[model samples]
Target: MSSVSIHPTAIVASGARLGANVRIGPYCIVGENVVLDADVELISHVVVEGHTHVGAGTRIYPFASVGHQPQDLKYKGEASRLEIGERCVIREAATLNPGTAAGGMLTKVGNECLIMASAHVAHDTIIGNNVIMANYVGIAGHCRIGDNVTFGGTVVVHQRTRIGAHAFIGAQSMVDGDVIPYGMAVGNRASLAGLNLVGLKRRQFDREAIHRLRAAYRMIFSNEGTLRERTEDAAELFKDDDLVQDVVAFITSASDRPILVPRNGQVASED
Candidate 1:
Protein backbone atom coordinates (compact mmCIF):
# COMPACT_ATOMS: atom_id res chain seq x y z
CA MET A 1 0.00 0.00 0.00
CA SER A 2 2.80 2.39 0.79
CA SER A 3 5.48 1.43 -1.77
CA VAL A 4 3.96 2.92 -4.96
CA SER A 5 2.75 6.33 -6.07
CA ILE A 6 -0.85 7.56 -6.07
CA HIS A 7 -1.88 10.71 -7.91
CA PRO A 8 -3.62 13.65 -6.28
CA THR A 9 -6.84 13.46 -8.27
CA ALA A 10 -7.64 9.90 -7.20
CA ILE A 11 -10.40 9.37 -4.63
CA VAL A 12 -10.01 6.21 -2.55
CA ALA A 13 -12.80 5.29 -0.20
CA SER A 14 -12.17 4.43 3.44
CA GLY A 15 -13.80 1.03 3.07
CA ALA A 16 -11.66 0.11 0.04
CA ARG A 17 -8.75 -2.23 0.62
CA LEU A 18 -5.45 -1.73 -1.21
CA GLY A 19 -2.66 -4.24 -0.84
CA ALA A 20 1.10 -3.77 -0.86
CA ASN A 21 2.79 -2.62 -4.09
CA VAL A 22 -0.48 -1.30 -5.49
CA ARG A 23 -0.33 1.92 -7.53
CA ILE A 24 -3.25 4.19 -8.31
CA GLY A 25 -2.69 6.88 -10.90
CA PRO A 26 -4.42 10.15 -11.78
CA TYR A 27 -8.20 10.67 -11.74
CA CYS A 28 -8.77 7.10 -10.49
CA ILE A 29 -11.83 6.47 -8.33
CA VAL A 30 -11.93 3.48 -5.94
CA GLY A 31 -15.26 2.93 -4.24
CA GLU A 32 -15.89 1.95 -0.64
CA ASN A 33 -16.60 -1.73 -1.17
CA VAL A 34 -13.77 -2.30 -3.62
CA VAL A 35 -10.90 -4.56 -2.54
CA LEU A 36 -7.64 -4.73 -4.51
CA ASP A 37 -5.13 -7.43 -3.74
CA ALA A 38 -1.34 -7.19 -3.67
CA ASP A 39 0.78 -6.00 -6.61
CA VAL A 40 -2.23 -4.75 -8.54
CA GLU A 41 -1.63 -1.58 -10.55
CA LEU A 42 -4.25 0.86 -11.76
CA ILE A 43 -3.39 3.32 -14.49
CA SER A 44 -4.95 6.76 -14.88
CA HIS A 45 -8.69 7.41 -14.95
CA VAL A 46 -9.84 3.96 -13.83
CA VAL A 47 -13.09 3.62 -11.88
CA VAL A 48 -13.66 0.57 -9.67
CA GLU A 49 -16.90 0.46 -7.70
CA GLY A 50 -19.91 -1.54 -6.51
CA HIS A 51 -18.48 -4.23 -4.25
CA THR A 52 -15.77 -5.33 -6.65
CA HIS A 53 -12.92 -7.59 -5.52
CA VAL A 54 -9.78 -7.73 -7.65
CA GLY A 55 -7.29 -10.54 -7.08
CA ALA A 56 -3.54 -10.32 -6.59
CA GLY A 57 -1.14 -9.25 -9.38
CA THR A 58 -3.92 -7.97 -11.64
CA ARG A 59 -3.33 -4.74 -13.53
CA ILE A 60 -5.97 -2.37 -14.84
CA TYR A 61 -5.04 0.13 -17.52
CA PRO A 62 -6.37 3.61 -18.21
CA PHE A 63 -10.10 4.40 -18.53
CA ALA A 64 -11.25 0.94 -17.41
CA SER A 65 -14.55 0.73 -15.51
CA VAL A 66 -15.15 -2.34 -13.34
CA GLY A 67 -17.95 -3.44 -11.02
CA HIS A 68 -20.45 -0.87 -12.17
CA GLN A 69 -24.16 -1.58 -11.78
CA PRO A 70 -25.59 -4.30 -14.01
CA GLN A 71 -27.12 -3.52 -17.40
CA ASP A 72 -30.12 -5.74 -16.79
CA LEU A 73 -33.43 -3.93 -17.10
CA LYS A 74 -34.94 -5.98 -14.29
CA TYR A 75 -32.28 -4.77 -11.89
CA LYS A 76 -33.52 -2.72 -8.94
CA GLY A 77 -30.34 -2.16 -6.97
CA GLU A 78 -30.19 -5.49 -5.23
CA ALA A 79 -27.08 -6.49 -3.30
CA SER A 80 -24.76 -7.95 -5.94
CA ARG A 81 -21.00 -8.50 -6.26
CA LEU A 82 -18.13 -8.81 -8.78
CA GLU A 83 -15.03 -10.96 -8.34
CA ILE A 84 -11.90 -11.02 -10.52
CA GLY A 85 -9.25 -13.70 -10.04
CA GLU A 86 -5.47 -13.49 -9.79
CA ARG A 87 -3.02 -12.20 -12.43
CA CYS A 88 -5.60 -10.78 -14.82
CA VAL A 89 -4.75 -7.87 -17.15
CA ILE A 90 -7.60 -5.57 -18.09
CA ARG A 91 -6.57 -3.30 -20.93
CA GLU A 92 -7.62 0.31 -21.47
CA ALA A 93 -11.29 1.22 -21.77
CA ALA A 94 -12.47 -2.29 -20.85
CA THR A 95 -15.75 -2.29 -18.94
CA LEU A 96 -16.89 -5.11 -16.60
CA ASN A 97 -20.19 -4.84 -14.81
CA PRO A 98 -21.46 -6.60 -11.70
CA GLY A 99 -24.22 -9.20 -11.66
CA THR A 100 -27.88 -8.62 -10.99
CA ALA A 101 -29.67 -10.31 -8.09
CA ALA A 102 -31.86 -12.31 -10.43
CA GLY A 103 -28.79 -13.68 -12.23
CA GLY A 104 -27.09 -14.61 -8.98
CA MET A 105 -25.57 -11.90 -6.81
CA LEU A 106 -22.04 -12.38 -8.08
CA THR A 107 -20.20 -12.35 -11.41
CA LYS A 108 -16.85 -14.12 -11.49
CA VAL A 109 -13.76 -13.81 -13.71
CA GLY A 110 -11.11 -16.47 -13.39
CA ASN A 111 -7.31 -16.22 -13.20
CA GLU A 112 -4.85 -15.18 -15.91
CA CYS A 113 -7.42 -13.58 -18.17
CA LEU A 114 -6.62 -10.83 -20.68
CA ILE A 115 -9.48 -8.52 -21.55
CA MET A 116 -8.42 -6.17 -24.31
CA ALA A 117 -9.36 -2.54 -24.89
CA SER A 118 -13.03 -1.64 -25.38
CA ALA A 119 -14.16 -5.12 -24.30
CA HIS A 120 -17.28 -5.36 -22.18
CA VAL A 121 -18.33 -8.14 -19.80
CA ALA A 122 -21.91 -7.49 -18.91
CA HIS A 123 -24.04 -8.57 -15.95
CA ASP A 124 -23.91 -12.14 -14.60
CA THR A 125 -21.40 -13.42 -17.16
CA ILE A 126 -18.89 -15.99 -15.91
CA ILE A 127 -15.50 -15.91 -17.68
CA GLY A 128 -13.02 -18.67 -16.98
CA ASN A 129 -9.25 -18.82 -16.54
CA ASN A 130 -6.68 -18.22 -19.30
CA VAL A 131 -9.29 -16.66 -21.53
CA ILE A 132 -8.56 -13.91 -24.07
CA MET A 133 -11.09 -11.36 -25.20
CA ALA A 134 -9.77 -9.25 -28.00
CA ASN A 135 -10.49 -5.58 -28.62
CA TYR A 136 -14.13 -4.49 -28.79
CA VAL A 137 -15.52 -7.88 -27.72
CA GLY A 138 -18.91 -7.67 -26.05
CA ILE A 139 -20.40 -10.44 -23.86
CA ALA A 140 -23.98 -9.99 -22.80
CA GLY A 141 -25.78 -10.89 -19.57
CA HIS A 142 -25.84 -14.41 -18.07
CA CYS A 143 -23.32 -15.77 -20.57
CA ARG A 144 -20.84 -18.45 -19.53
CA ILE A 145 -17.43 -18.52 -21.24
CA GLY A 146 -15.22 -21.44 -20.36
CA ASP A 147 -11.49 -21.83 -19.68
CA ASN A 148 -8.72 -21.41 -22.28
CA VAL A 149 -11.11 -19.73 -24.71
CA THR A 150 -10.07 -17.07 -27.24
CA PHE A 151 -12.49 -14.49 -28.58
CA GLY A 152 -11.55 -12.56 -31.68
CA GLY A 153 -12.05 -8.82 -31.93
CA THR A 154 -15.64 -7.51 -31.96
CA VAL A 155 -17.18 -10.93 -31.25
CA VAL A 156 -20.61 -10.49 -29.67
CA VAL A 157 -22.36 -12.99 -27.39
CA HIS A 158 -26.04 -12.87 -26.73
CA GLN A 159 -27.66 -13.22 -23.33
CA ARG A 160 -27.68 -16.68 -21.68
CA THR A 161 -25.32 -18.06 -24.30
CA ARG A 162 -22.84 -20.70 -23.17
CA ILE A 163 -19.48 -21.27 -24.83
CA GLY A 164 -17.64 -24.36 -23.71
CA ALA A 165 -14.00 -24.64 -22.67
CA HIS A 166 -11.15 -24.39 -25.18
CA ALA A 167 -13.27 -22.92 -27.96
CA PHE A 168 -12.15 -20.22 -30.39
CA ILE A 169 -14.69 -17.63 -31.50
CA GLY A 170 -13.82 -15.67 -34.63
CA ALA A 171 -13.91 -11.89 -35.05
CA GLN A 172 -17.18 -10.00 -35.51
CA SER A 173 -19.14 -13.20 -34.92
CA MET A 174 -22.59 -12.90 -33.40
CA VAL A 175 -23.10 -15.91 -31.12
CA ASP A 176 -26.68 -16.48 -30.09
CA GLY A 177 -26.56 -20.07 -28.76
CA ASP A 178 -24.23 -22.59 -27.18
CA VAL A 179 -20.79 -23.38 -28.56
CA ILE A 180 -19.49 -26.82 -27.69
CA PRO A 181 -16.01 -27.61 -26.40
CA TYR A 182 -12.90 -27.95 -28.60
CA GLY A 183 -14.61 -26.25 -31.54
CA MET A 184 -13.70 -23.39 -33.85
CA ALA A 185 -16.76 -21.18 -34.29
CA VAL A 186 -17.46 -18.28 -36.68
CA GLY A 187 -20.19 -16.47 -38.67
CA ASN A 188 -22.71 -13.65 -38.29
CA ARG A 189 -25.30 -15.92 -36.67
CA ALA A 190 -22.38 -17.99 -35.47
CA SER A 191 -21.91 -21.66 -36.38
CA LEU A 192 -19.31 -24.27 -35.62
CA ALA A 193 -16.89 -24.30 -38.53
CA GLY A 194 -14.58 -27.07 -37.32
CA LEU A 195 -12.35 -28.26 -34.51
CA ASN A 196 -10.04 -25.63 -33.03
CA LEU A 197 -6.76 -27.06 -34.19
CA VAL A 198 -4.63 -24.16 -33.03
CA GLY A 199 -6.15 -24.26 -29.59
CA LEU A 200 -5.82 -28.03 -29.40
CA LYS A 201 -2.19 -27.90 -30.42
CA ARG A 202 -1.44 -25.07 -28.04
CA ARG A 203 -3.11 -26.93 -25.22
CA GLN A 204 -1.45 -30.13 -26.45
CA PHE A 205 -4.59 -32.14 -26.91
CA ASP A 206 -3.58 -35.76 -27.56
CA ARG A 207 -3.96 -37.37 -30.98
CA GLU A 208 -6.71 -39.68 -29.74
CA ALA A 209 -8.65 -36.73 -28.32
CA ILE A 210 -8.41 -34.62 -31.47
CA HIS A 211 -9.36 -37.53 -33.67
CA ARG A 212 -12.40 -38.36 -31.58
CA LEU A 213 -13.56 -34.75 -31.50
CA ARG A 214 -13.28 -34.54 -35.27
CA ALA A 215 -15.38 -37.64 -35.71
CA ALA A 216 -18.03 -36.36 -33.33
CA TYR A 217 -18.23 -33.03 -35.18
CA ARG A 218 -18.70 -34.86 -38.46
CA MET A 219 -21.60 -36.90 -37.19
CA ILE A 220 -23.49 -33.94 -35.75
CA PHE A 221 -23.23 -31.47 -38.61
CA SER A 222 -22.42 -33.52 -41.71
CA ASN A 223 -23.96 -36.97 -41.33
CA GLU A 224 -26.32 -37.95 -44.13
CA GLY A 225 -29.04 -38.90 -41.65
CA THR A 226 -31.38 -36.73 -39.61
CA LEU A 227 -30.36 -35.53 -36.16
CA ARG A 228 -32.71 -38.09 -34.60
CA GLU A 229 -31.16 -40.71 -36.82
CA ARG A 230 -27.61 -39.80 -35.86
CA THR A 231 -27.63 -40.92 -32.26
CA GLU A 232 -24.81 -40.59 -29.75
CA ASP A 233 -23.96 -44.24 -30.25
CA ALA A 234 -23.23 -43.51 -33.93
CA ALA A 235 -20.32 -41.32 -32.82
CA GLU A 236 -19.25 -43.81 -30.14
CA LEU A 237 -16.14 -44.84 -32.03
CA PHE A 238 -14.36 -41.94 -30.33
CA LYS A 239 -16.13 -42.31 -27.03
CA ASP A 240 -12.86 -43.12 -25.30
CA ASP A 241 -11.80 -39.52 -25.82
CA ASP A 242 -13.22 -37.17 -23.21
CA LEU A 243 -13.11 -34.23 -25.57
CA VAL A 244 -15.31 -36.10 -28.02
CA GLN A 245 -17.65 -36.95 -25.18
CA ASP A 246 -17.87 -33.24 -24.53
CA VAL A 247 -18.99 -32.65 -28.08
CA VAL A 248 -21.57 -35.41 -27.89
CA ALA A 249 -23.05 -34.03 -24.68
CA PHE A 250 -23.29 -30.54 -26.17
CA ILE A 251 -25.24 -31.68 -29.23
CA THR A 252 -27.55 -34.05 -27.35
CA SER A 253 -28.07 -31.44 -24.65
CA ALA A 254 -29.02 -28.64 -26.99
CA SER A 255 -32.73 -28.24 -26.33
CA ASP A 256 -32.83 -24.66 -27.61
CA ARG A 257 -30.91 -23.92 -30.82
CA PRO A 258 -29.86 -26.78 -33.08
CA ILE A 259 -26.18 -27.60 -33.13
CA LEU A 260 -24.58 -25.64 -35.98
CA VAL A 261 -24.54 -27.10 -39.50
CA PRO A 262 -22.39 -26.32 -42.54
CA ARG A 263 -23.85 -25.01 -45.78
CA ASN A 264 -21.79 -27.55 -47.73
CA GLY A 265 -23.42 -30.34 -45.67
CA GLN A 266 -20.02 -31.47 -44.43
CA VAL A 267 -18.50 -31.33 -40.93
CA ALA A 268 -14.84 -30.59 -41.69
CA SER A 269 -13.81 -27.30 -43.33
CA GLU A 270 -11.55 -26.85 -46.39
CA ASP A 271 -8.95 -25.09 -44.37
Candidate 2:
Protein backbone atom coordinates (compact mmCIF):
# COMPACT_ATOMS: atom_id res chain seq x y z
CA MET A 1 0.00 0.00 0.00
CA SER A 2 1.19 3.54 -0.75
CA SER A 3 2.33 5.47 2.32
CA VAL A 4 0.97 8.73 0.90
CA SER A 5 -2.02 10.13 2.77
CA ILE A 6 -4.51 11.04 0.06
CA HIS A 7 -7.95 12.14 1.24
CA PRO A 8 -10.80 10.03 -0.01
CA THR A 9 -12.30 12.96 -1.86
CA ALA A 10 -9.06 13.75 -3.68
CA ILE A 11 -8.71 12.76 -7.32
CA VAL A 12 -5.20 11.42 -7.91
CA ALA A 13 -4.68 9.76 -11.25
CA SER A 14 -3.25 6.26 -11.18
CA GLY A 15 -0.15 7.38 -13.06
CA ALA A 16 0.69 10.23 -10.68
CA ARG A 17 3.86 9.79 -8.65
CA LEU A 18 3.63 10.46 -4.92
CA GLY A 19 6.65 10.21 -2.66
CA ALA A 20 6.76 9.15 0.96
CA ASN A 21 4.66 11.14 3.43
CA VAL A 22 2.99 13.21 0.72
CA ARG A 23 -0.49 14.43 1.59
CA ILE A 24 -3.30 15.31 -0.80
CA GLY A 25 -6.16 16.97 1.02
CA PRO A 26 -9.86 16.92 0.25
CA TYR A 27 -11.03 17.67 -3.26
CA CYS A 28 -7.49 18.08 -4.60
CA ILE A 29 -6.67 16.82 -8.08
CA VAL A 30 -3.32 15.40 -9.12
CA GLY A 31 -3.00 14.68 -12.79
CA GLU A 32 -1.40 11.63 -14.37
CA ASN A 33 1.94 13.21 -15.06
CA VAL A 34 2.22 15.22 -11.81
CA VAL A 35 4.99 14.36 -9.37
CA LEU A 36 4.81 15.27 -5.70
CA ASP A 37 8.09 14.79 -3.88
CA ALA A 38 8.59 13.60 -0.35
CA ASP A 39 6.78 15.47 2.43
CA VAL A 40 4.76 17.70 0.09
CA GLU A 41 1.34 18.73 1.39
CA LEU A 42 -1.66 20.01 -0.48
CA ILE A 43 -4.01 21.62 2.01
CA SER A 44 -7.30 21.42 0.13
CA HIS A 45 -8.97 22.04 -3.22
CA VAL A 46 -5.60 22.23 -4.97
CA VAL A 47 -5.12 21.25 -8.59
CA VAL A 48 -1.72 20.08 -9.82
CA GLU A 49 -1.98 19.17 -13.46
CA GLY A 50 0.07 18.83 -16.62
CA HIS A 51 3.75 17.92 -16.38
CA THR A 52 4.38 19.66 -13.05
CA HIS A 53 6.77 18.68 -10.30
CA VAL A 54 6.49 19.91 -6.73
CA GLY A 55 9.75 19.59 -4.83
CA ALA A 56 10.29 18.03 -1.43
CA GLY A 57 8.84 19.56 1.75
CA THR A 58 6.76 22.14 -0.09
CA ARG A 59 3.34 23.04 1.25
CA ILE A 60 0.63 24.35 -1.04
CA TYR A 61 -2.42 26.04 0.49
CA PRO A 62 -6.07 25.63 -0.48
CA PHE A 63 -7.30 26.55 -3.95
CA ALA A 64 -3.83 27.13 -5.46
CA SER A 65 -3.47 26.03 -9.08
CA VAL A 66 -0.13 24.56 -10.05
CA GLY A 67 1.17 23.44 -13.44
CA HIS A 68 -1.71 24.72 -15.49
CA GLN A 69 -1.51 25.47 -19.22
CA PRO A 70 0.05 28.73 -20.27
CA GLN A 71 -2.12 31.75 -20.90
CA ASP A 72 -0.39 32.41 -24.20
CA LEU A 73 -2.35 32.20 -27.42
CA LYS A 74 0.70 30.73 -29.10
CA TYR A 75 0.71 27.74 -26.82
CA LYS A 76 -0.90 25.02 -28.90
CA GLY A 77 -0.74 22.13 -26.45
CA GLU A 78 3.02 21.91 -26.27
CA ALA A 79 4.50 19.59 -23.62
CA SER A 80 5.68 22.27 -21.24
CA ARG A 81 6.38 21.99 -17.53
CA LEU A 82 6.16 23.85 -14.24
CA GLU A 83 8.82 23.00 -11.68
CA ILE A 84 8.70 24.23 -8.07
CA GLY A 85 11.76 23.70 -5.90
CA GLU A 86 12.04 22.48 -2.33
CA ARG A 87 10.53 24.04 0.80
CA CYS A 88 8.33 26.56 -0.96
CA VAL A 89 5.08 27.85 0.52
CA ILE A 90 2.52 28.47 -2.18
CA ARG A 91 -0.28 30.43 -0.53
CA GLU A 92 -3.99 30.18 -1.30
CA ALA A 93 -5.42 31.05 -4.71
CA ALA A 94 -2.01 31.49 -6.41
CA THR A 95 -1.63 30.24 -9.98
CA LEU A 96 1.58 29.09 -11.68
CA ASN A 97 1.54 28.17 -15.32
CA PRO A 98 3.92 26.21 -17.54
CA GLY A 99 6.11 27.67 -20.24
CA THR A 100 5.49 28.13 -23.94
CA ALA A 101 7.70 26.58 -26.61
CA ALA A 102 9.34 29.88 -27.43
CA GLY A 103 10.37 30.25 -23.80
CA GLY A 104 12.20 26.89 -23.62
CA MET A 105 9.22 24.89 -22.35
CA LEU A 106 9.60 25.32 -18.59
CA THR A 107 8.50 27.64 -15.81
CA LYS A 108 10.61 27.37 -12.66
CA VAL A 109 10.20 28.51 -9.06
CA GLY A 110 13.27 28.06 -6.86
CA ASN A 111 13.76 26.89 -3.30
CA GLU A 112 12.41 28.51 -0.14
CA CYS A 113 10.07 30.87 -1.93
CA LEU A 114 6.91 32.39 -0.49
CA ILE A 115 4.31 33.01 -3.19
CA MET A 116 1.61 34.98 -1.43
CA ALA A 117 -2.11 34.59 -1.89
CA SER A 118 -3.65 35.46 -5.25
CA ALA A 119 -0.25 35.93 -6.91
CA HIS A 120 0.19 34.81 -10.52
CA VAL A 121 3.37 33.50 -12.10
CA ALA A 122 2.88 33.28 -15.81
CA HIS A 123 4.39 31.19 -18.60
CA ASP A 124 8.17 30.60 -18.73
CA THR A 125 8.90 32.75 -15.66
CA ILE A 126 12.14 31.83 -13.86
CA ILE A 127 12.12 32.74 -10.16
CA GLY A 128 15.22 32.31 -8.03
CA ASN A 129 15.69 31.07 -4.48
CA ASN A 130 14.41 32.81 -1.35
CA VAL A 131 12.18 35.13 -3.36
CA ILE A 132 8.96 36.58 -1.97
CA MET A 133 6.01 37.68 -4.04
CA ALA A 134 3.47 39.52 -1.92
CA ASN A 135 -0.27 39.21 -2.38
CA TYR A 136 -1.61 39.78 -5.87
CA VAL A 137 1.81 40.24 -7.44
CA GLY A 138 1.56 39.30 -11.09
CA ILE A 139 4.68 38.28 -12.99
CA ALA A 140 4.18 38.06 -16.71
CA GLY A 141 5.65 35.55 -19.12
CA HIS A 142 9.40 34.89 -19.59
CA CYS A 143 10.64 37.19 -16.80
CA ARG A 144 13.85 36.16 -15.04
CA ILE A 145 13.77 37.06 -11.34
CA GLY A 146 17.05 36.61 -9.49
CA ASP A 147 17.68 35.22 -6.04
CA ASN A 148 16.56 37.06 -2.89
CA VAL A 149 14.37 39.44 -4.89
CA THR A 150 11.18 40.70 -3.22
CA PHE A 151 8.13 42.07 -4.97
CA GLY A 152 5.73 44.02 -2.78
CA GLY A 153 1.99 43.58 -2.95
CA THR A 154 0.12 44.00 -6.21
CA VAL A 155 3.24 44.72 -8.28
CA VAL A 156 2.96 43.79 -11.94
CA VAL A 157 6.01 42.94 -14.01
CA HIS A 158 5.96 43.09 -17.75
CA GLN A 159 6.90 40.15 -19.90
CA ARG A 160 10.59 39.30 -20.57
CA THR A 161 11.90 41.79 -17.96
CA ARG A 162 14.87 40.79 -15.83
CA ILE A 163 14.92 41.58 -12.12
CA GLY A 164 18.39 41.05 -10.67
CA ALA A 165 19.34 39.49 -7.37
CA HIS A 166 18.63 41.35 -4.12
CA ALA A 167 16.39 43.85 -5.86
CA PHE A 168 13.43 45.39 -4.00
CA ILE A 169 10.39 46.51 -5.92
CA GLY A 170 7.96 48.48 -3.79
CA ALA A 171 4.22 47.90 -3.62
CA GLN A 172 1.98 48.51 -6.66
CA SER A 173 4.94 49.18 -8.92
CA MET A 174 4.70 48.50 -12.62
CA VAL A 175 8.03 47.06 -13.75
CA ASP A 176 8.50 47.24 -17.49
CA GLY A 177 12.27 46.81 -17.84
CA ASP A 178 15.39 45.39 -16.27
CA VAL A 179 16.14 46.10 -12.59
CA ILE A 180 19.81 45.71 -11.68
CA PRO A 181 21.04 43.72 -8.71
CA TYR A 182 20.82 45.43 -5.30
CA GLY A 183 18.68 48.17 -6.78
CA MET A 184 15.55 49.71 -5.21
CA ALA A 185 12.76 50.53 -7.62
CA VAL A 186 9.50 52.32 -6.77
CA GLY A 187 6.74 54.50 -8.25
CA ASN A 188 3.95 53.80 -10.69
CA ARG A 189 6.12 53.21 -13.73
CA ALA A 190 8.99 52.07 -11.47
CA SER A 191 12.13 54.15 -11.56
CA LEU A 192 15.37 53.17 -9.92
CA ALA A 193 15.44 55.15 -6.68
CA GLY A 194 18.68 53.87 -5.14
CA LEU A 195 20.47 50.78 -3.95
CA ASN A 196 18.65 48.41 -1.61
CA LEU A 197 20.67 49.56 1.37
CA VAL A 198 18.17 48.41 3.99
CA GLY A 199 17.98 45.01 2.35
CA LEU A 200 21.76 44.70 2.16
CA LYS A 201 22.14 45.59 5.82
CA ARG A 202 19.46 43.16 6.86
CA ARG A 203 21.12 40.42 4.85
CA GLN A 204 24.35 41.20 6.77
CA PHE A 205 26.48 42.07 3.75
CA ASP A 206 29.98 43.18 4.70
CA ARG A 207 30.47 46.89 5.36
CA GLU A 208 33.22 47.25 2.76
CA ALA A 209 31.22 45.49 0.03
CA ILE A 210 28.18 47.64 0.70
CA HIS A 211 30.28 50.81 0.59
CA ARG A 212 31.80 49.84 -2.76
CA LEU A 213 28.38 49.02 -4.19
CA ARG A 214 27.11 52.44 -3.11
CA ALA A 215 30.01 54.15 -4.85
CA ALA A 216 29.41 52.16 -8.02
CA TYR A 217 25.69 53.00 -7.96
CA ARG A 218 26.42 56.72 -7.73
CA MET A 219 28.86 56.59 -10.63
CA ILE A 220 26.56 54.53 -12.82
CA PHE A 221 23.56 56.86 -12.43
CA SER A 222 25.40 60.18 -12.42
CA ASN A 223 24.55 62.71 -15.14
CA GLU A 224 27.44 62.06 -17.46
CA GLY A 225 28.00 59.72 -20.39
CA THR A 226 25.61 57.04 -21.61
CA LEU A 227 24.67 54.10 -19.40
CA ARG A 228 26.92 51.88 -21.47
CA GLU A 229 29.93 54.07 -20.81
CA ARG A 230 29.20 54.21 -17.09
CA THR A 231 28.78 50.45 -16.96
CA GLU A 232 32.13 49.89 -18.71
CA ASP A 233 33.90 52.32 -16.36
CA ALA A 234 32.34 50.79 -13.27
CA ALA A 235 33.28 47.32 -14.46
CA GLU A 236 36.93 48.37 -14.79
CA LEU A 237 37.15 50.32 -11.53
CA PHE A 238 35.28 47.86 -9.32
CA LYS A 239 36.60 44.69 -10.94
CA ASP A 240 37.59 43.27 -7.58
CA ASP A 241 34.32 44.05 -5.85
CA ASP A 242 31.94 41.13 -6.39
CA LEU A 243 28.72 42.99 -5.62
CA VAL A 244 29.64 45.97 -7.78
CA GLN A 245 30.71 43.63 -10.54
CA ASP A 246 27.27 42.04 -10.45
CA VAL A 247 25.62 45.40 -11.06
CA VAL A 248 27.95 46.17 -13.95
CA ALA A 249 27.46 42.77 -15.50
CA PHE A 250 23.71 43.06 -15.32
CA ILE A 251 23.83 46.43 -17.07
CA THR A 252 26.08 45.19 -19.88
CA SER A 253 24.15 41.97 -20.37
CA ALA A 254 22.05 41.83 -23.53
CA SER A 255 18.40 42.53 -22.83
CA ASP A 256 15.45 43.22 -25.08
CA ARG A 257 14.09 45.88 -22.69
CA PRO A 258 15.77 49.04 -21.47
CA ILE A 259 17.30 49.17 -18.03
CA LEU A 260 15.39 51.02 -15.34
CA VAL A 261 16.89 54.36 -14.32
CA PRO A 262 15.93 57.20 -12.00
CA ARG A 263 12.86 59.05 -13.27
CA ASN A 264 14.39 62.47 -12.69
CA GLY A 265 17.04 61.96 -15.37
CA GLN A 266 17.20 60.78 -18.96
CA VAL A 267 18.95 57.39 -19.37
CA ALA A 268 19.23 57.21 -23.15
CA SER A 269 22.54 57.61 -24.96
CA GLU A 270 24.18 61.04 -24.57
CA ASP A 271 25.75 62.54 -27.67
Candidate that would win on TM-score? 2
Q: Model 1 segments beyond 4 Å from truth?
A: 228-231, 254-258
Q: Which runs of model 2 end up more than 4 angstroms from their true locations?
A: 266-271
Backbone clash pairs for candidate 2 read none
lDDT string for model 1 (38-147, tens) is 88889889999998999999999999999989888898988699999999999999999998878888789999999999999999989999999999999998888899
Return the clash pairs for model 1, or none: 1-20
lDDT top scorer: 2
Each prediction's whole-model lDDT (CA): 0.85, 0.93
Question: Under the 3 Å rule for N, CA and C atoms, how many clashes does model 1 have?
Answer: 1
Q: All candidates' TM-scores?
A: 0.93, 0.97
Writing each residue's lDDT as its tens digit, candidate 2 over 140-191 gives 9999999999999999999999999999999999999899999988878999
Roughly what TM-score does model 1 have, to 2 decimal places? Answer: 0.93
